[model samples]
Target chain A: MDEKFAAIGEAMPRLLDGLVVTIELTIFGAIAAFILAVILGLAAASPAKGFRIPARVVIEFFRGTSLVVQVFWLFFVLPLLGIDLHPMLVGVMALGLNYGAYSAEVVRGSIQAVPTGQWEATTALSLGPIQRMRRIIFPQAWALMIPSLSSLLVHLMKGTAIVGFITLADLTYQLEQVKRTAGTLFTYGVVGILSYFVFALVLMYFMNALEHQAKHKLGQGKSLWRILSPAPPASTPAGGAS
Target chain B: MIGISAAFEWHWSAAAEVLPTLLTQFVKVTLLVTVLGTVIASILGLVIAMAIRVLPRPLSEAVKWIANVIRMTPIIIQLLFASYAFLSLDLITIGVIVYGIHYATYMSEVYRAGIDSVPKGQWEATTALSMSTLRTWTAIIIPQALRATIPALGNYAISMFKDTPYLLVIGVVDMVNAARIYGGDTYRYTEAFTLVGIIFLLASYPTSLLIGRLEKRLAYKT
Candidate 1:
C-alpha cells in the first residue's frame, strides 16, 4: 500500500511535467486551428470554383483520412522531405490541420446563417466586404461556431497525446514509462485520473467562459453550462450533411 | 508518410500471396473490434449520457470531465498506453477497451441528445401511468431515443470501422497493417494500401447508405 502510494507520488510530478507539454501542444495547435479555420471558412465562401473547389478538396482530404496518418507523415516523412520540424511541431500541425477542416465547415455554416438582409444592408450602406464581415457578420457567426469550435478544441487537446508516440515525451508516454517501472495498474489508473481532473477543469473553464461571453453578445443569455451544454441534435434533417 | 500519389509497381505473385490474407484478417479484426466496441459503447454511452443528464452536478460534472479526457487523447496514445502499459499479453482486449471508451465519449453525447429529444410530456405521461423508471425507460425513452439516433449511431459504427486501422499502430495486422507491412517488406505499398482503402470504402459506403435508409424509415414512422 505504502509502496503504491509512494510510487504514485513520485510518478505524478513526472507525469505532470509531460502533461504540461500536452497542454502546451493543445493550446498552440488550437490557436493555429482557429486562425486557419477562419481563413479556410472565408475561402470556402468564395463564389468562384477557382477558390471553392480546391478548398473543398483540401477539406475533404483532411476530413477523410485518419489524422494519425497525417501526424506520422508530418513527423516522419516531412523530415525526409527536408522539413525537419520537431515532433511537437508536427503534432501541432497535424492537429491544427485536422480541426481546421472541420472548423471551415462550421465557419461557412455560421456565416451562411446570418440573415440575407444583413448582407444587402451592408452592401446598400456601401460597406466593403471586409467591413461588412468584420462589423456585421463576425459576431453572429461567432455564436454559431462556438459549440463546434469548443468540441474541436477538445478533440485537438486529446490529439496532443499522440506526440508520445514519436518520442516527444508527453503524459501518455510518461505513463508508459511508469507502467514499465512500476508494472502495476495503479500507475495508469492514477495517471488517467490526474489527466482527467486537469483537462476537465481546463476545458470546462475555457469552454464555459466562451459560452458565457458568446451568450452575452448573442443577447439571449443562459447559464454558462446551460449554454455550452450539448443541445439535443435537432432532428436529423432529411438532408443532413453526409 | 507515403504520398497519396506514390505508385509502386507490384509483382503478380506478391499481390496474390498478400491480398487475400490481408482482406481476410482485415475483416476478422475490424468485425471483432466493431462488434465489441459498439456493444460496449452503446450500453455505456447510454448510461453515461443519462447519468450526465440526471445526476447531481458533481457526478454529472465528473462524468463529463472523464469523457472529455478520454475524448481528447488520441487513439494511438491510448492504444499504446493500454497495450503496453498494463496488458501487453492481451493486445486485442486493450485495443477494444481503448477504442470503445474513446468512442463512448462521443457516443454518450449522441445518446444525450437522443435522451433530451424525448419531450417532457412523455415523462409526465409515464409518471401518470405509475410506470417505474426502468419500465418508463425501456418502453418509452430508449425506443424514442434510439429511433431518433439511428443516423448518428450508424455514423459512429462507420467511424469505428474506419478507426479499426489505428489498431495497426499496435501491430494488429488488419488491412491497413497488412498494407504497411507488405509495403515495408516488398516495397510495393501502392497496390496494397490503395486496395485496402478501397475495401474500406466498399464496406463503409454501403453501411453508410443503409444508415441513411434506416434514418428515413424511422423518420416516417415517427
Candidate 2:
C-alpha cells in the first residue's frame, strides 16, 4: 500500500499535464460538437429533402463508423493528400465530428419532442423558419436537450482518452508511461480510472447546473436543490394542478 | 504523374491484393468480437440493472459508482489494463470482456430506463396478486422491460461492432490491425486504411439503418 501510494505521488505531476490535455480536448471537442449538432440536427429536422439528405448522410457516416479509425484517417491518411494537421487539431476534429453525429440525433429528438401545438402556434404567428426556431421552439427544446446532452458530455470525456492513442500525451498516455516506469498496472490503472471518474463527476456537476438553469427557464419549478428537497404539506399542497 | 499520385491514387491492384486478408479478418475477428461482446454486455447489463434495483440503497449506490467508473474510462485503457492483468485469457477474449464491461454500463442504463418505464399499475398488480419476488420480476416485470429494451440493445450492438477495432491495441489481429499490417508491408497506407473504413461503413451503415427502422417501429408500438 505504501509503495503504491509512493508511486502515485511520483506520477502525479505528469498525469496532471495529461489531464489538462484531456480537459482541453473535451471542452474544444464538445464546443465543436454542440455547434455542429444544432446545425446538422436542424437540417435533419427540416422538411426539405435537400437539407435533410446531406445531413443524414454526414451523421450516419460518422456515427456508423468507428471513431478510432476516423482519428487514424485524419492523422495518417490526410497527410498523404498533403493536409498535415497538428495532433491536437486531428484529435479535436475527429472527436468533434464523431460525437457531433451522435449528439445531432439528441438535438433532433429533443426538437421533435416539443409539442405539436407549439409549432402550430408559431406557424399561426406568421413566423419564418429562423424566427420559429430562435424565438419559440428552441428555448423549450434546449431544456429537453439537457439531460441527454449531459450523458453525451460524459461520453465525450471518456472518448478523449483516444487522443492519447494518436500521441497527444493525454491522461491515458501518461498513465501508460507511468505503468511502463512503475511496472505496476494495478496502481496506475486505479489512479487513471479515479482521475477519469473525477473528471466525469466535474462534468456531471456542470451539466446538472445547466439542467437546473434550463429547467428554471422553462418554468418547470424552483431551483434543482429546492425542487429536490421534500416540501411541507401546506406549502406544496397535493398534485391537483397541471 | 507526381501531382496525381501524391495528391490521391486508388491503387486498385494493391487494394485487391489486401482484400482477401481483410475480408477473412472482418468475418472471423471483427464480427466475432462484436457478437461476443454484445452477448456478454447484454447479460451483464441485465444482471447489473437487477442488482441495482434489488439491493439496499447504500450497496446499490456503490454498485452505481463502480459502473460509472467503468463507463467513464476509455475502452482502450481498459483493454490495455486487462491485457496486462488478465493474462490467463487470450487477447481476443480479453478484448471481448473489456468491450463487454465498458459497454455494459451503457446497456445497464438502458435496462434501468426500461425497468423504470414499467407502469406502476403493473407493479401494484403483481403485489396485489401476492406474487413471489422472483415470480413478480420474471413474469410481470422483465418481459415488459425487455420488450422496450430490445431496440436499444440492438443500437448498442451496432456501436460495439464499430468499436471492435480498439482490440488491435491488445494484439487481437482484428481487421483494422490486419489493415495496418498490410499497409505497413506494402507502403499502401491509403488503400489499406480506406478499405478498412469502407468495410466498416458497409457493415455498420446498413445495420444502423435497420436499427433506425427498429427504433421507429418500437416507438410506434409504445
Error of 2 at A54 (Å): 1.0
- The Cα RMSD of model 2 versus the native structure comes to 3.7
User: Whole-model lDDT for model 2 versus the true structure?
Assistant: 0.85
Q: Model 1, A83-146: lDDT tens per residue?
A: 5797778888888887888788889889998899988999899999888899888888888788
Clashing pairs in 1: A158-B72, A158-B73
Give the alpha carbon lDDT tens digit for every residue of A1-242 in model 2: 67767776898899899999999999999999999999999999888999999999999888876887788888877777777799999989988999999999999998999999999999999999899999889999999998889888887887787776577999888887787556647644777777888888899989988888778878876676665668723455568673
Question: What is the lDDT for A207 in model 1?
Answer: 79
Enumerate the candidates' DockQ scores in order: 0.15, 0.49
Q: What is the C-alpha RMSD of each candidate to the true structure, in Å?
A: 8.2, 3.7
Worst 10 residues of 1 chain A by lDDT: A73-82
Top-DockQ structure, candidate number: 2
Instruction: Please report how far candidate 2 places residue A16 from its true position, in Å.
Output: 1.4
Best by TM-score: 2
lDDT of 1: 0.75
